[model samples]
Target: MSFKINFDSENVSTGEFQLVAEGKYEASIINAEAKEWQGQFSIGFDVEIRSDVEQKHQGAKVLYNTLYLSSTNPEYAENTEKKRNSFLVACGYSGKQSLDLDEVVKNIIGKSVLVYIKHVEDKNDKERKYPRVSFVAESKVNPPQPSGPPITVGSDDLPF
Candidate 1:
């Protein structure tokens, strides 16, 4: 019997910022440690990113904190050997911003980003299967600024 699966069209969008990046992120031979079969098998990849933004206002200052890697593909599962076959695929911007706070704020307003990724698997030199991929947004923020270096107050300065 033949079976078919359908993905929710409404939930998927091939639009801008849908995937921060797309293309082969990694490839490696399966069971590389196993002797005799070394370099005999491998897996290919394509990755995407989904990013969303929210506006927060602190007085006159507006901060645009973006959410990165909002989602992924090839759905990760627990207790599955297939998990090891996957690589760290992500989409986001890099490099320091030369623009000041005002320019950065203006550049980030009202932006929606999404990334789409795909995995290609092969067995015996023939394509075997393709799986649907998805990822949840995991955001990491920088720490707050610290005031000056540590100060050592002298005992003489202490008030009794």
Candidate 2:
């Protein structure tokens, strides 16, 4: 059985920015890959998103529409050995909207992004099979920030 995986972006974050003109903004696919399975099994992935609006830009507003995904490519490999055991997918986005950073911050900030997965099968190829899949989003704390030089009494010794 053959399978394909894709995401809107490899990385996504919430921030503030000024818009000069009104135009349609779209999220692009950062990366994609496929894996084939020979034995009976299942595969899954976890997706998450983080925002710096609250800490960086307070009271900033923003707007966003529904996220979308599409299957643009479907090419079967000729070599059977090229098949994969399973697939692991992840994505992210970075941009701005009309609203301030604070407005959209609460919606996406410190929140776990969930992705829904569906299986597609070739009607003509009944012999081939695909594994069932599901998605789960878990909220996580922001990553630790890098500390700069530290100021202390006495001589100016570099601190890490």
Candidate 3:
């Protein structure tokens, strides 16, 4: 008889972190699919966490979410729109007009963004804290902003 932990501990995460910790992480949209539920269709996003945040998320691939359209259900118009708008905005959408599933997927999939995480506890007895996305911004490809006072020098300073 033997007892052993076979996996690499360094590759795993406990998923314990402070609430509302702002972190810049890269993510890849793994998949998009539509599902019908309660007589309505919703586009579900499967995103894969990437870069540094992967450790914080315990190597988790995605934070799952579903986008609902107002046209999907008249009774849930408000709720649907809210979900749809928030999801789109989080995916770096800035357009006023709503887009179809294919368009949304095209815009989000394979794209990375900066996100702020918030911890919220459930109403249940345990009240476990769950990390939720509070803010999202388009990933900056260029180098970081320059720091220090502005220089107003003549063109003669140039090497060219």
Candidate 4:
């Protein structure tokens, strides 16, 4: 007996090209890690879209976000800091306590979050597009509603 491999038909992907549309998705930080390039430091996240969403792209693994922690250029450094801060705030970090960067990266893994995905054209190949996780926040099952008594409106409050 002998076995043969079919190069053309045996190991090819048959799934169609799909993109997660621009919208918010319930997701989780499946993985996280510290990254560096050209002496610049950063945190990278791998997010997975939850299967409960209505879209067909659910359960897809997507690159969530990247936070650059170190940079040589002043302006770029400042922008990176702001972006990281915003991410921390969204994650419910008060910004008052001291944070260990490595610990923070590890803690974020497996955390449920709401991810905003957007598409942008590839710089080198303008015709091609990719989904980019633009923002992330703590997952809230339901948005908050206003409390207290409802006010009664009179005709006097009406304006033409």
Candidate 5:
């Protein structure tokens, strides 16, 4: 008649953890927001990993590094621009420069992306680690391929 939440469970069904090795994971931007930080506009993304990353990390999530692309100060313009271009390339939009920030955010919603990331330990605390997106490309999950060519297998071919 009642239920209890098991926060003490050793397994994390959907949470964040350190990825020991460099691995590719399918993720989707669940949230993206532009904020004015220090004097510039920077966009932050909340990327959720939806792949079976070694079974234990199936629903692991991570925060995408944010960079300022627009600043009130003039000194940060050139560097910001370069970072913007790199962002586009990493997001699979290389060679296109006419896209608006809002458009980029909106267009990426619900879109699955394959990201190559690495885990880095926090400087202050060596034991703590976080996942950082190193590169991103189009998701390769869909457009499924057949396991084998069409074959007719009788029950005799199966091993019980």
Candidate 6:
């Protein structure tokens, strides 16, 4: 099917992408997906910076982290596990209970965390830089509390 369409190219504008500032910011896990690369299993996280933190940025989204589930090297494997554990703990995983990676990842969606971002120069192109989530932890900021109507007592209700 073909139809006539009206379009204007002059009004369209493109802006250069900006990397999130290198600092700690409150962010939420917008997506969690299982991914495999070169026979290695991993989970990729897409984190969005809270808009309230900075007005100009308007909540920039970034590829936060990729946690590998398996690695052939012993040291790398141990480090990977530690990273996963740290992420789980930051998302409210208690060590007192049994752990499940799939469930933990699912439950962590929408969870708030303090992410420390750092800019790294691209290996191939030094002029190009990217934001990397160097570290993350439980957010110190508390969730908003509910407010209710003020309680009032009538004069008649009070007993002498």
Weakest lDDT window of 10 consecutive positions for candidate 6: 50-59
Off by over 4 Å in 1: 1-55, 59-139
Off by over 4 Å in 6: 1-14, 53-58, 96-98, 144-160
Candidate 4: residue 115 Cα off by (Å): 1.2
Candidate of highest TM-score? 6
How would you encode candidate 6's per-residue C-alpha lDDT over 35-105 as one tens digit per residue?
Answer: 77788877788788876554335578878477676788886888777776777777888767776657867
lDDT of each: 0.28, 0.28, 0.59, 0.77, 0.67, 0.76
**Worst-scoring 10-residue span by lDDT in model 4:** 137-146
TM-scores of the candidates are 0.16, 0.18, 0.46, 0.67, 0.56, 0.69
Runs with alpha carbons beyond 4 Å of true place in candidate 2: 1-90, 96-113, 131-160
RMSD value for candidate 3: 11.9
Per-residue lDDT tens digits for candidate 2, residues 12-103, read 55664443122111112122222224532221122222233133222222222122121223453322112211111122223332433233
Candidate 3 similarity to native, TM-score: 0.46
Q: Give the per-residue Cα lDDT of candidate 2 at 89.
A: 18
Query: In angstroms, how far off is 23's CA in candidate 1?
Result: 31
Off by over 4 Å in 4: 1-15, 53-56, 70-79, 142-160
Residues 18-110 of candidate 1 have per-residue lDDT tens digits of 221223212111111111123332222222221112221111111111222112323523412233212221112244434333333343322
Worst 10 residues of 1 by lDDT: 27-36
What pairs collide in candidate 5? none
**Decreasing TM-score order of the candidates:** 6, 4, 5, 3, 2, 1
Comparing 3 and 6 on lDDT, the stronger one: 6
Worst 10 residues of 2 by lDDT: 80-89
